[model samples]
Structure formats: C-alpha cells, structure tokens
Target: MKLYSGIDLHSTNSYLAIIDGKGKRIFHEKLPNDITTIVQRLELFAGTLQGVGQHRGCDREKA
Candidate 1:
C-alpha cells in the first residue's frame, strides 16, 4: 500500500496530514516548526510513506 502526505507550513506551527492512495485519511496533527519534531511525527508513518505534497504559504510544490 502506498501512502501520501501533505504539509501546510506556517510561521510557528505546521499541519501534517497523511492519507492512503484511496484518499482515506490516516493521520493528522499540528506540530511545531522544528525539524526533529516533524521527523518524529513522520516516523509514525515510516516505511509506508511514499511521497510528500507540501503547500507552504502560497507556493505549491512537491517535496
């Protein structure tokens, strides 16, 4: 199974969302703007995570 993630980054916090290929939401959380914290949160999804679709402010891109 393939999983996808979307991250909405902000000044002090960020919104992270994960979903399966069928668009079923798997995880959602608000996290601090720290790499370690974000990494820890993402670790929960680990090996199954395939790609990331990030929307930072007005810029839309894949990361």
Candidate 2:
C-alpha cells in the first residue's frame, strides 16, 4: 500500500487529500488555514498508512 498527501492552502479554508498507489482516494478532508495543522494531519495520516513506498501530489494550491 502506498500513500500520498496533498494540501491545498486556501485563504478561506484549506483542503487535504490522501491517495493510494493506484490513485485511489483514502481521505479527503477540510482543514484550517494553517501550516502546523496540515503537517500534523499529514504526519498522523502517514503513521496510519505505513509501509507505503512513495508519496505524491497530483495538484497543489499555494497558500
């Protein structure tokens, strides 16, 4: 199982997406507009999805 993280830091509200090796979405969530929160979420999700070979970003939006 492979996991990837994508964080869209928008002005109003940021969005996060987690994708698997075969391009399947596991988690798509809306988070606060902050870097710390995003990192924390990513780390937590990363820990949950261990043994993943690689992480990738499909599309990204600058905060």
* lDDT, candidate 2, 13-46, per-residue tens: 7778888878898888898777687777788775
- Candidate 2 clash pair list: none
| Superposition TM-score, candidate 1 onto the true structure | 0.84
* Model 1: residues with Cα > 4 Å off, grouped in runs: 59-63
lDDT of all predictions: 0.91, 0.69
Q: Summarize candidate 1's per-residue lDDT along 10-56 as a digit string, tens digits.
A: 98999999999999999999999998998898888889999888888
Per-candidate TM-scores read: 0.84, 0.63
List RMSD in Å for every model shown.
5.8, 6.6
